[model samples]
Target: MGKLDLVMFEEEFTQLQEIIGRLQVDSSSKVVFLVDKNGQQIAASGDLRSIDATSLASLTAGNVAATDGLAKLIGEKEFSLLFHEGEKDNLHISIVGKRGILVVLFDHNSSLALVRLRVKKASRELQEIFEMVEKRAQSQSGESSKFESPFSEITDEDIDKLFGD
Candidate 1:
């Protein structure tokens, strides 16, 4: 919210993308992604070939926001992660930055401790990347105002025209 002076380095973003991809391979996980706070997919890897990372990213953020809110109400600080293990599907979600979230999907063979350990290291790297992204966004905001709103500019008519009945 404050003036973002630190820019997200492209090199770091690329490094993070690679890091997640490597983790997927090393841990035998099926999916991994880096998402912005608004739910936009920043980077991804693994068996998410068909899944939509953008939507997942947003849902992950919602999960973090809910937990963070709860923590505040309980007089606790924001924790790094939340894990959900079901009969079949398992999910590990973590906050990477103020405006970033990481979601990992795996099977029963993967241990929560391993995921937590990997995430701790990943989170440290992501925090650095996000600081840079914030700075870049702040610097670019001045020039970005000239463009029309990407979402607002598209209307129902445009959608219907693109895929008409």
Candidate 2:
């Protein structure tokens, strides 16, 4: 089956925010954020005053999709991690729980080794949280399927009578 749409609870959201904040600080990154595979922002932390978050998330997702195509062509299952070094900054993007993307932005002040180590730990925590969200979504879907709508038995005649001319 395809991935279920996430229904983020407040508790999970809070956890995600905490994780992102800690990651930004721990990795010594300028910014850090999480986005779902569909390019929906989950949580973000650190400096975002100059970034277009919506566009970044959407573009990141598209980048991942393009990379996935390349990976397949090379007979690789998936490239879980990607890095781009720019003149003044760098981007470290990793896949989390096969459902989310974790992006970290850093510059000369940080070392790639430190950022990768911090990201590894953060990714594990994020994966667990995402799994919890998935389980909750599955259970809720199952429960909804068992629910009998109150209007299910209503007939056309009943509806017409309620609004009769």
Candidate 3:
């Protein structure tokens, strides 16, 4: 019930990168990425430049939200995983730590079973990291009010300069 501020420290970010790296190899996935529930991309590995990551992250979050709603309507608590098979490519999405999502893109080279297996392991690790982040955030809550937000330093002229005529 406390304020949840998700902050990614350097160590946590490195662990996330490592998790995705291992997943790509173990699952033989074409791409692996993690996105927060709010549609913010956290980390990625493999052939990421080949896809529109921004759009994909946003859509994946939306997909998870929609599926969760459907599950509630059906009297289920939630649907944690989703898979979509394509003619040449496939997608596997898994909910992680209640605040993040793991997405895997694969082709004929990898089977859903393998992706699912690897994702399960990765999700466990990711969940732990997310918990740690939450704990850290909670511990720092007392000091958070004293800290100035980075955005607070940006002047209106700074934003206008980025799109000046």
Stronger candidate by TM-score (2 vs 3): 3
lDDT of 1 by residue, 90-137 (tens): 888887768778888888767777777777777887787677667667
lDDT of 2 by residue, 70-114 (tens): 999999988999999999999999999878999999999997999
Best candidate (score: TM-score): 3
How far off is residue 33 in model 1, in Å? Answer: 1.2
Which residue runs of candidate 3 sit more than 4 Å off their true CA positions?
Answer: 1-3, 145-152, 156-165
Which 10 consecutive positions of candidate 2 have the poorest summed lDDT? 144-153
Tell me the TM-score of model 2: 0.86
Ranking of models by TM-score: 3, 2, 1
The superposed Cα distance between candidate 1 and the true structure at residue 41, in angstroms, equals 1.4
Runs of candidate 2 exceeding 4 Å displacement: 1-3, 145-165
Q: What TM-score does prediction 1 earn?
A: 0.73
Preferred candidate (lDDT higher): 1 or 3: 3
**How high is the lDDT of residue 10 in model 1?**
67
In the predicted model 1, the residue pairs found to clash are 6-135, 7-132, 7-133, 7-135, 7-136, 8-132, 8-133
Deviation of model 1 at 147, angstroms: 15
Clashes of each: 7, 0, 0
